[model samples]
Target: MTLAGCVSTPHPEKNTTAIPVAPEPEPVRPLMYAAMPDERFPIPAVKLDQLDRRFWRREVDYQTSERPGTLIVDTPAKYLYHVTPGGRAMRYGIGVGREGFAWSGRAIVAYKRQWPRWTPPDSMVARQPSLQPYSIANGGMDPGLRNPLGARALYIHEGGKDTLYRLHGTPEAFSIGKAVSSGCIRLINQDVIHLYENVRDGSPIVVVPDPSMSNIAVSSL
Candidate 1:
């Protein structure tokens, strides 16, 4: 029996080849600022490397008492809150005004700038004549190292006039949880970047009075 299932014949032509396909690349996000060296300054010995994340407290389910589009600076808490709808807020750590520079008022953000030029105020220049050379009329200091305004600035105005107060960034990240500014509210460069992304020109700001002083007044009564 030759068998019903037995056949062997040579077939020499068969082709098998694999094809390759490349993957699509991811889109890149543009950076807000180029990487740069830190400016020279008389920096204090604060432990910036050890950031206390606990200093920033957000009540997840709790709504802010403030209203939307209003800025609230809680000096004692060292936090600045931008009230949003539904009781939420965009909170940021800040350096508040020092004792003599503490102030409270309603103001509008008149203008904002990136890598802003800085000129010492005339009064500041008068007290420190060395700064006289850097006054605004003298073209102000060029943008770079040594400008106290840091990376960005938002000028505050009241009654259609500049109040000479500012919300600005600082290289001194360690100052984030302290009251050490001359009169302005100081934010870390990173935090200010976050804030700058959220606000627009002419945003209203309501600086609250220092709680300690308010408490003292209440106790005195």
Candidate 2:
């Protein structure tokens, strides 16, 4: 008694054996972007590489003393957490300032902007002469895909003074989960749009300083 059932196999006719298999209807490519705000110039959807998924935005169980809607940036881990009521937080991948360029402190998202304009700071212009033309006088880079500030910006302020550190969007999706910014925190464009539409202004922002640079306790977050 053969316990394994014998599978029937088809024998190809030697006389006419070429069975044409219909080529897999090319896999439907997912729509990269929705209707653009400007019909003349559409925003192309960012094609994500497999590596990005490892740092992709996601919601996970997170225990924190902070209340809901709190924004905590983990500079070391390159992750930002938006605390929720429950023991959960929505986390996003981010790019932070490089070694000497990093800063840390407590601040608030005092203001928000959509398709915000960007003017390179004088200091930045001094560093890069190319940006000299776009200083406060000449008006900075016009808001668009090529703009370093991708789609939105969350102004960080403390005691009514601008920290010059922003939580903003970047067209450079590949920069996620890395240290490569002037001093601001950068998220993927699509990720920022999702965050901008949800995170409220006045939300608390705590920039977690790079531990290698400074010992700022972030276990609380």
Candidate 3:
């Protein structure tokens, strides 16, 4: 009975059926966004607390051909979903471009930045000459709580060409679920921070144009 030299490999349970236990849903934390997200930035700390609960970030059941790790932005629905395994997604409220500024297409997250500085484009400076001070020539707006770009920015690109669009955080929580931005997609600071931490660079993104194309899913648990 010399069993010391023998090694056993347990066979996988090939005949067993898989029973998927759904994940429990998490509640949206009230102050996660509006209050001070970080101790360093003090200017926009208090505004997000007044934001609507529906706009808060949460996980939900979803349906789409886009595999897990793909990000979908439903422009008309004012929501962005990060697809996950087992028919689930993490959804975040968003503010899109107003009217003529709205656009829909495919793009990839080319890069990401934390507390990014914003330089007013030449066209922007032309429309609001006062912004000239923050133009490329002036070194742009310094990254801070008061900056329009907010806590994080995900640069979107298509076929190696810059789309000039961004998924970014904003201090203005009131803008969530509305069409108000010049063109960039906006989220609450806390939500954006969460997204920035989760998504990997070069992930594919899909922007569905109309509400009819949106597929809303409920969260389990």
**Clashing pairs counted in every model:** 2, 0, 2
Which ten-residue region of model 3 has the weakest summed lDDT? 212-221
Q: Write the per-residue lDDT of candidate 3 for residues 165-202, one digit (tens) a residue.
A: 89998878789988888778999888898899899999
lDDT of 1 by residue, 90-180 (tens): 7777888777666677778888887778887887778788887789779788664357787678898888978777888777766778878
Stretches of candidate 3 exceeding 4 Å from the true structure? 1-31, 37-39, 42-49, 211-221
User: Which one wins by lDDT: 1 or 3?
Assistant: 3
lDDT for model 1 comes to: 0.68
Model 3 residue 204 CA deviation (Å) reads 0.7
Error of 1 at 85 (Å): 1.7
Of the candidates numbered 2 and 3, which has the greater lDDT value? 3
Instruction: Give candidate 2's TM-score.
Output: 0.78
Top candidate (lDDT) = 3
Which regions of candidate 2 fall more than 4 Å away from where they truly are? Answer: 1-41, 214-221
Q: After superposition, how far is residue 102 of candidate 1 from its true place, in Å?
A: 2.3
Q: How well is each residue in 1-221 modelled by candidate 2, as lDDT tens digits?
A: 75656875566764556688987453332342233455223555555652266577788999988889989998899999999877999889899987777768788899898888899888889999989778998988788777787788899888788877888887676788888898889987777877888888899987777778643322222
